[model samples]
Target chain A: MKHTLSVLVQNKPGVLARTAGLFSRRGYNIESLTVGVTENENVSRMTIVVTGDDTVVEQVTKQLNKLIEVIKVSDLTKESYVDRELVLIKVTADGSNRGEIMQLVDVFRARIVDVAAKSLIVEVTGDEEKIVALIAMLKQFGIKEIVRTGTLALGRGPKVIQSGKD
Target chain B: MNLTGAKALIKSLEYEHVDTIFGIPGGVVIPIYDELYQQDAITHYLVRHEQAAAHAADGYARATGKVGVCMATSGPGATNLVTGIATAYMDSVPMIAITGQVTTDLIGNDAFQEANITGITQPVTKHNYLLHDASEIPQTIKEAFHIASTGRPGPVLIDIPKDVQTMTAPFDYPKKVHLPGYQPTYEGHPGQIKRAAKAISEAHRPVIYVGGGVKISGASEEVRALAETILAPVTMTLMGMGTMPADHPLSLGMLGMHGTRYANYAVTESDLIIAIGARFDDRVTGKIASFAPNAKIIHIDIDPAEIGKNVRVDIPIVGDVKRVLQKLMPMLKQTRTKEWMEKVHTWKREYPLEFEVTGLRPQYVVREISRLCPDAVVCTEVGQHQMWAAQYFSHRHPRNFISSGGLGTMGYGFPASIGAKIGRPDETVFDLAGDGSFTMNCQELATAVAYDVQVKVAIFNNGYLGMVRQWQELFYDRRYSQTKLSEINFVKLADAFGAHGIRVDSASEVAPAIKEALAVPKPVIIDFRIEPEECVWPMVPAGAALNEIIDAKSGKV
Candidate 1:
């Protein structure tokens, strides 16, 4: 089972390493992890996508909560959440296929961020499913290179994972 | 008055009511040591090795329920404290470790005596900090102590560079730290407590499974109350010894691998298991799939993470054990488990913990020591002697038996005894060590004599690492391998360190030697020559089920 966890932690040196160390030590496979500064300068939020069974996910969440730097851990998979993955794909394109590639990019709601002699850098942003579909369509065009920012997530609607003092 | 960072650190420790610290000073931490010299409020015990310093602090913390403090220099000194810090962390002992870093400018420059102690100890510590500004010393120290001593206790580290120690800052200790992320839940949920109490009252065969948390939370009395009220047999983990008096009718000696036959039997047959202050460690759960197969479990612990980490529970209460027990005890209705109690007693009678009394045995030595110093705080290094102490020795009070339960660190006993003695100077402290384990950090004998910390040590000199030897004999067709030890004159080694030493080869000599060692107002080491082939009985092989325990004498499973 794939589980997405939104972890809020104190923005201090080594906190990220400590949190990551827990996963490696427990041998839990982390599919994707993205850490960034939060609204509060002293706090940071991490979006981690982990693949494990129920027991493994429970242990991971509990262990994360044990870290003193960690403020809150919520299984975003259990709730209605919005997840986004950003990908920059460089696809091989020549004069013959350039127009068709642009048309496909438009169909996928992506944009040509950069243009080169034989390739077009297409920037795509969407949920994992949509991004995967776009990548499948672009792979037919011979992908020159691909880079992705791992999934980042937030709960939908009025459900807020508060970080401030309760 | 403008004070240096060292002075601010000292003031913060003073505010925490810390009276003693253990450490070995070096170049990077000289400024802090100098400040320590000018103060009389806290006494510093100069340990021979930085490792011993950390172990001693751990021992003190476990014995006295106070946050143990240890200090060390940069690089090697800081690295040496890793094992001890990890030991404390594994056992949930409250400890504060302060290390000196190279000057701020030379931190990442690969200068002499420069190591990133905070980064090195990140996984091992509950929390850690590296101070860049002198003004943060007092607050950081305050936070470190609070974090180390609160909730599920663990070691916390603070690494300060030499420049920060010399820099001047006003000392202002915070009245109360405002850590929004670190509040520990102390009270159990009312519904959960009610459900747990109802289960206990309704259980036909109930068992109270306790652990080190009982001692940490000061819940021994509450555990007793709950057990007596519900007529449940109490089985404790190795670290949970002394939570229930060994002689009590309801008490079953330590459970799991190498646990007493009756205790393991009771756990196997119980219909309801009330686990308190204990994480179901692998050592205590021989083959988790078969552990308490028929029982409905109720787990109570201060740390929420420990509740269902290892075992599933029907009712889980996340709160301090003592507090939760107090509430649950009052709500629990008395149960009539006469038939269940009688069945447990029959098992106890059928399989009592015993060993042959023909030759000099480590079990005999531990028994004799227990007879002589029952009230003394006892600690043990890992191996056969540690299990023997846990099995044979009767602990009557909480915090009376201390050992490296989680990590099972070998060389833990000697230094831990030093810390235990310093924490309670009026009480007697003993470390039961194996010959193999005693050699790991015997240099700490020098630290004991230097500080006049009178900690008695009894080494079971079987001439081999007996635990490993036992495993080899049982499973590996007796290969022996690296388990054998070369002979050493332990008496001379003790004498060289300005401490007393004795050698006993016969059973009759054991009592007299213990008496003599007790009378001596210095650290004493007694080497008892025992049979090398003697193994701990009622063995449950690793990965085997709890019910499949093998009897040593009859070879029956």
Candidate 2:
């Protein structure tokens, strides 16, 4: 099972390493992780995707909460939430296949961010399934290179993961 | 008031009311030492080694329930404290370790005597800091102390650069700490407490399993009260030895590997296990699937992660042990089970702890010491002697028996005894040590002598690392590789260090030597020559279930 956790921690030096080190030392498998400052400059939010059973994931959440810098941990996997990952794919393009690639990108609502003589860089943002589908479709055109940002998540509606003080 | 960062550090310690420090001076720590020399509020004990300093601080914390503090220079000095820090971390002892680091600019340049201490201690410490500015001294020190001594107390380190120590800063100690992420749950949930109380009241064969958390939370009285009120037997883990009186009728002594047979049996047969302040460690829960298979476990610990880390927990209450016990006490109904008590008593009578009385046995030495100094604080170094001490010595007060329960550090007892004596000067202190373990930090005899610390050490002088040899004899075809330890004349070594020394080779001479050593005003070491191959009995072979115990008489499960 996969659990996406939203962790709020103090914006201090080595916070990332401390959080990452825990996952490695405890043998928890991390699928994807993204960290950035939240609305409050003093606090940072880490969106981590981990794979474990219910018991192991519960232990992981509890262990993450034990770190002194981690203010709060919210598992958004079960909740009604929104998640997105931005990926840029460079596909081999020629006069014949360029139109098909552009047409395919339009259908997925993706943009051709960069164009070169031999490749076209398509930028797309969606959930994991959509990104995987886009990459699979672009594979026919031959993906020259690809880069991806880790999965970022947030709860739906008005609910939010706050540090109580904020 | 404006002061140097080093002075600010000392001032912050004074604000925390720290009366003593265990530390060694080094190049990077010279500025801190210079400031320490000018202070009258805190007395610093110059230990022979950095590791001993940390262990001594840990002993002091265990004995006094205060946050222990140790300091060392960077690089080698800081690295030496790693084992002691890990030891304290594993046992959840409240400790602050201050290490001097190289200048901030040279931190990543590999300057001489520089080390990334905070990075090195990340896993072992509850939290750590690497201060680049002198102004952060007061706040960092306060936070370090608060974090170290709070819920699930553990070691915290502050690595201060040399230039930061020399920098000037305003000395203003914060009266309150604002750590958003570090608040611990001190109160148990009302619904969970009710459930636990209901389970306890209805349990016919209930057992209370206690751990070091009881001592750390100062819940010894509460634990005893709960057991007595419920008419339940109490079994303590090794770290929880002194939390309940060993002579109490309900007391089942220790449980787990090398634990009393009755304690293990009672737990194995228990219908309800009210585990207070205890994590179901592998040693305590051998063959986890079969450990207390019939019992409904109620685990109460300050650390939530410990609740179901091992065995399945029925009711988990994440709160301080003392507070949780208090909340649950009012909801409980006193009940008795005469049949269950009788069964436990039968097992106790059948499997009483015993050893041969023919030779100068290590058990005999520990038993004699317990008989002579009933109120004395006992510490033990790792190996066979540690298990023997745990088995033979009767503890009646919290913090009275301090040993390396978790990490099982080899040379913990001797230096720890020095700190224990310093913390509680009125009580007699003894380090029940092995020849191999004691030799690791015997150099601390100089610190003990110089400070007039009257700590008595009883060295069970067996020629081999007896515990490892026992494992080999039992399971490894008696291939005792690298277990033999060359003997040293401890009496001469003690004399050389300006401490009293005595050697006793016979069982008849043990008591008299202990008495003589007690009367001596300074540190004393007694070398008791015993049977070399004597193994700690009542053994549960590694990975064996608690019920599969091998007794000395039967030599079989």
Best by lDDT: 2
For every candidate, give the share of true A-B contacts it also has: 0.68, 0.74
Clashes of 1: 0
Q: What is the DockQ of candidate 1?
A: 0.65
Candidate 2, residues B42-107: lDDT per residue as tens digits? Answer: 999999999999999999999999999999999999999999999999999999999999999899
Model 1: docking quality category:
medium
Considering only N, C-alpha and C atoms within 3 Å, which residue pairs clash in candidate 2? none
How high a TM-score does candidate 1 get?
Answer: 0.98
Q: Across residues A1-166, which tens digit of lDDT does each residue of candidate 2 receive?
A: 9999999999999999999999999999999999999999999999999999999999999999999999999999889999999999989998888999999999999999988888889999999999999999999889889999999999999977888784
Residue B120 C-alpha lDDT in model 2: 91
**What is the lDDT for B460 in model 1?**
95
Say which candidate scores most in DockQ.
Answer: 2
